[model samples]
Target: MSGSVNMDMFGTPLQKLFSLMQLTLVIAGLMGLVLLLWLLFRALMPKKGQTKRGRKGK
Candidate 1:
């Protein structure tokens, strides 16, 4: 292979900035998705039964 390397592969500053923004957006989206799933799980769970009269020992 030739020793010459393509400088274009390094990309421009603007391109790099855009890629960073995209990565940030993806991470934020995943976090929001996890939060939504957790909320749904909590909502679907059954609540524990409690006696209205008070403690049975009393």
Candidate 2:
């Protein structure tokens, strides 16, 4: 049969793999955005009982 596995995986298998990779990338991007937002909030907002030193100084 000159056995060919390469010919078989080119169909649904490849499509499934591509879709999985796309989903992974999308989830990773969402997580990165959430992390970025959290970091931005932490950097911009004052901690408990602490005022903005920059505002106070100015």
Candidate 3:
């Protein structure tokens, strides 16, 4: 029917909006995870010049 065709055309924009939103959420979550890991590593690591081998430099 003519009405159905009109409805289908309108649905395309909604689909595109949802796809973009999903992509944004995925990228944001991955970036957050990377930042969290970096913070954890920094917190767990030793301070500068604390290790005997670190002073030797290699």
Off by over 4 Å in 3: 1-11, 46-58
Error of 1 at 16 (Å): 0.7
- lDDT winner between 1 and 3, please give it: 3
lDDT of each: 0.63, 0.72, 0.75
Clashing pairs in 2: none
TM-score of 3: 0.60
Residue-level lDDT of model 1, residues 1-58, one tens digit each, is 2222223323567666776798899999999999999897556543434434334423
Over 1-58, each residue of candidate 2 has an lDDT whose tens digit, in order, gives 3235444545568766886798899999999999999998778765645656545452
C-alpha root-mean-square deviation, each candidate: 9.6, 8.4, 8.0
- Residue 52 alpha-carbon offset, candidate 3, angstroms: 14
Worst 10 residues of 2 by lDDT: 1-10
Per-residue lDDT tens digits for candidate 3, residues 1-58, read 9687557756899866776798899999999999999997666556654654454453
* Cα lDDT for residue 34, candidate 3: 100
Q: Is candidate 1 or candidate 2 better by lDDT?
A: 2
